[model samples]
Target: SNLVYDWVKAAILFGVVNTVACLDHLDPPQPPKCITALYVFAETHFDRGINDWLCKYVYDHVGGEHSAVIPELAATVATFAITTLWLGPCDIVYLWSFLNCFGLNFELWVQKLAEWGPLARIEASLSVQMSRRVRALFGALNFWAIIMYNLVSLNSLEFTELVARRLLLTGFPQTTLAVLFVTYCGVQLVKERERTLALEEEQRQDKEKLE
Candidate 1:
């Protein structure tokens, strides 16, 4: 029903579902189907809108690449602000890229901007710088949110512990590798010490026997 209440609920659900899905696909230790489903939901539902804005706002800014801050922010802020301000029931604030959902190609934008006018160059440079910083900022926030959500949501199903255990398991191969290296070093050390001790004992016996 394009009703205000329904639209708001859909908007909120859309944000959560998309962010979770993106995070699930991030590589290495992944989440369950339920979690992955959220990602699918997000991409299918929201990506079109995002990509639409990408086509409109991003493609032109850096000459076919939405790599710079001006274009990236223009898209992110515009979409985010619009969703929050109008698309939902209540005013909710969230960054959609927190789930590793979006990546901006800053280098491409800069390369394209390399031959622009002074003002265009300045704007492009600043946008690139700002985009880098914003990426880091959103990443940190996403991590914090993940930690918080896992702590709360994993209790009944032990989902949090599962993730932690997976992290440990993923390290097992590397840890075993380091252990093997250390054991080799220890064995060499022991052999060297034994050789020195044996040589010393032999010298002492020779001296005593000679005397």
Candidate 2:
């Protein structure tokens, strides 16, 4: 509905302003209390109810046989969500910038995903053997695009450019090292996959010879 769209738009604007302001504090886990506040605000004014998405995408995914993966996935989802609302447009400009900002963290977290749970280990091991086509399919970058849009879209509003310029002065330079480290983490994940596949093939052929 158009109303829904308008609400989303409003929520995005509010989120961007909030995020830029919070950059100075930058607390770990972003303080659950803060997130809760945003959730309430979005729900009340913007109609972006957390319950719907939380139930559909997040609820069923956590706390059970697959519980171990929950922490990592939840963290990733939170980071993704915050960036989406804060960045403001779900566009490419913010997407790349956000990635560069947290790419290293993402790379490490992705690696952590490979080890975080029984399911995670199985998935990572399978990924190592899976075809590049399958990998590409799973690598859908829309999540990233949304975050960028959120960030850049906010720039359309008053004072956004002023805030971004300030962020650039401090956040950008510091994040450079993080970016390089994350890039290295990505390479490590690739190498780890290759090693697993090579080992898997060796064992398969050995079994075949014996049988």
Candidate 3:
């Protein structure tokens, strides 16, 4: 699992660097093509890696003790993967901005770590505290910076025109599929949350009776 995570991270970082480098040397059409390919590659590997890890975790831990949440969690992860896979290159800025603003990726990682045994729980606790401090220190400033940068770049006539052409040429179907998947996943997530809360409450009431 660690090996897979490390390799995926390395691939994404490398892809980002290569894409930027290509922009400097490649011609207009060639660079976009190259970037599109890299984007597909990164998103594919990233989603698969995450899914694999989650499955492994479920099999190891949740499969025995918390089986009830498996379907919901799997659906949520699947939705996330599908949405990311279909997002056009133009959507990367928005994705990055959202992640920066909420630190969703970081929070997810910490949550997973907390599910692990004792040592990982310690790490997860520390991570939560550190994340809170980091957010307190820089979250607002970083969020605004990301928002402004993306807004400026996306608002440009050239960029907007490029995105429009890309969408017309290749992004429409992918975007539509992503929206449908997200809607389905959102419903699943809500149902899962309610179910989990009810189960927790039931367990609490039973414990009170026992006491």
Candidate 4:
């Protein structure tokens, strides 16, 4: 069914599955047949409905090199709103559209922030270990902001109540700082992994030359 809950679940599962599949692929290098088939298998077209195609088209072509026609961010969100309207004017549809639009923009925001000059300067002044820790700290702050932004779409009506309790009953600020200190570890790990792979490729080439 076209339930918002189902959409949220699918989005979460998509993240977990893609992360696991990517990490595992680096080691054993086996076909993640299960992942390949299930990445919204062709069967999923029935439910997923290729609804995102228009937004994608705008992102790719319309929002292309000549962006005066439509700014990229506005183009994506507008097309998505159009898609939601096409689906119908249900409350859940509107909520779903808002949440997904946030997700889309949140993705771009993160990328933009990563490329921002200040972040680069911060990293430059620090040791490699500290620089990565700083990035992850920033990443962790982003994670919570993201969770709060999408909480309604991901949960039941009680999401409002849940937010209330989180704010009222707990040391929310402290917990947030703790989460930041926990490290946004993913980026550092992926960077090191890629560096290792490159080194391995170089070693293989050297061996071939020696032979």
Q: Which candidate tops lDDT?
A: 4
Candidate 4, backbone clash total:
1
Clashes of 1: 5
1-211: candidate 2 lDDT, tens digit per residue? 2334554566666567668767876432221221111211112123234434543465334422323444545544554564456546555545543453354245445546655688566665675446443333333232222223334443342344454455345477776445434434443455456679999999999999999
Clashing pairs in 4: 136-184
lDDT of 3 by residue, 47-131 (tens): 3444455445542333333233444344344444444454543555445334432333333444455567995655566776564
How many clashes in each structure?
Answer: 5, 12, 0, 1
Residue 67 in model 3: shift from native, Å? Answer: 14
Residue 42, candidate 2: alpha-carbon lDDT: 18
Off by over 4 Å in 2: 1-46, 58-71, 74-90, 93-149, 156-162, 167-211
Q: Whose TM-score is higher: candidate 2's or candidate 3's?
A: 2
Q: What is the lDDT of every predicted structure here?
A: 0.43, 0.44, 0.44, 0.53
Off by over 4 Å in 1: 1-50, 57-64, 86-165, 168-211
Q: Output the better candidate (1/4) by lDDT.
A: 4
lDDT score for residue 190 of model 3:
42
TM-score of candidate 1 versus the correct structure, residues matched by position: 0.26
Worst 10 residues of 4 by lDDT: 35-44
Candidate 1: tens digits of C-alpha lDDT, residues 6-74? 335655666677677778873222212222112111122323454455446544433334455566545
Using all chains and alpha carbons, the TM-scores for the candidates as numbered come to 0.26, 0.24, 0.20, 0.50
